[model samples]
Target: MSSTRQFSFEFFPTKTDAGHEKLMQTAAHLATYNPNYFSCTYGAGGSTRDRTIDTVKHLNDVIKVSTAPHLSCVGDTKADLRQLLTMYKNSGINRLVALRGDLPSGMGMASGELRYANELVEFVRKETDDHFTIAVAAYPEMHPQARNFEEDLRNFATKVKAGANIAITQYFFNADCYFYFVERVRKLGIEIPIVPGIMPITNYTRLARFSDACGAEMPRWVRKQLEAYGDDTKSIKAFGEQVISEMCERLLQGGAPGLHFYTLNQAEPSLAIWENLKLPR
Candidate 1:
């Protein structure tokens, strides 16, 4: 494994003051590990646009680390996106995670000015001319809305061709799935770094719920093990750490570019995994 491989963490903008404080502390804690950058997720349909910007700014200003704000095309106008790009540029944020975010429940797809993530990446390049390092989403198991695996791969290639500098995948448990996805994309002539998104298993119920919603496959054995633990929080966390740590080792050994953890605004789970991997801070 390359010692200089990139590592990053993702967060969502918090709605409450307390939540914001907690996230700040979490970011601070993780910063000690020298992650490549921190990413803040934009709310669906641009609902929390202001909060996302504010959170990104706060992390950059306070944590003194490069922060990337997620920019989603759904429910946004070209003018609105232009303004946001300028704002982030002015705030000294030079990285972005471009996404075709989910539409809010009941909002039709036609409501958005931009239709896909490729269009969003194109717009960013046209508007900013490489001022930002653009990162786009990829799915190993296939995006939930995709009609099939080929279509999903093509869509990801479209984003890369549109100027995405990197690709971060949806979190998955199975290492073979990630390796296969990378090999397939390589065959498609997409060479951008595809970083595996890692979700530490802290809460089985919550993890299962999220996995189901996001199309991440939780293997039957893993599911059964988690289910057997029931409400045993300690055992669940220990088992989760062991499972995720081993997965990380395999991914790194298999030549994944790096890891991007879905921190979910917490510190310990991700930190524990980092420690388990014995990665340099």
Candidate 2:
């Protein structure tokens, strides 16, 4: 994954050796398509700390793809963040996904030095200057915690102002939501690329659970159609591919900068959509 690609993939750090092998195999397969980079997710409050560092390094070093490790400030100290930033910098990692992250369960409320994403973005910029390209999250359908759309937009604008280099949106079924969100963000005078986060539709039940938790709307028609497929994995996947692929085509045609896929550490679903789009390899 390299050379200025308009698409990229995301994976989570595996906790087991076999899982690691599968992820590596997936990365190797996706690498042939030339993603901009392979991004590995970080767990809340640094829960998956070491695995994330090790996984990111392996993907970059073994798979030879540029990797971006997600860094969140939900339950970390300034010193904790500073040390990790220094470690990554020393390792030749040049990009990061800066997030406020979810509050790890059993934590009453956020107790981190940096409570919000803008603060984290500012901290990263202050600590490392322009050394790393920082990507912040964008909620097309509004963050579940956001009071209203206006407040969410303002928060996003603040994060951008705090030195975020780019934004990757939460996955949505509606292209109109992405377009409208981008339009609103642009009205605030922020011009960084807002890449739409794509979740390949593999399992409907899991997708439903994830969407419910993340505030991503699964359109009623889409839900009903998926419901009709009931336990038929093949039909579910085929339908998912069609719907997601068509929406992706509309998004690209409507002027999205690029697509960032939440690959779930698998290659087939994403590759199915990629082939559907006939996207440059």
lDDT of each: 0.93, 0.92
List of clashing residue pairs for candidate 2: none
Among all candidates shown, the one with the greatest lDDT: 1
Q: Residue by residue across 1-281, what tens digits does model 2's lDDT show?
A: 22343698999999999999999999999999978888999997889999999999998888988899999999899999999999999998998999999888898678789899899999999999999999999999999999999999999999999999889999999999999999999999999999999998889999999899989999999999999999999999999999999999999889888899999999999999999999887
lDDT value, residue 20 of candidate 2: 93
Which segments of candidate 1 are over 4 A away from where they belong? 1-3
Q: How do the predictions measure up, each by TM-score?
A: 0.98, 0.98
Q: In model 2, which runs have C-alpha deviations exceeding 4 angstroms?
A: 1-5
Candidate 2 residue 109 C-alpha distance from true site, Å: 1.9
| Prediction 2 TM-score vs. true | 0.98
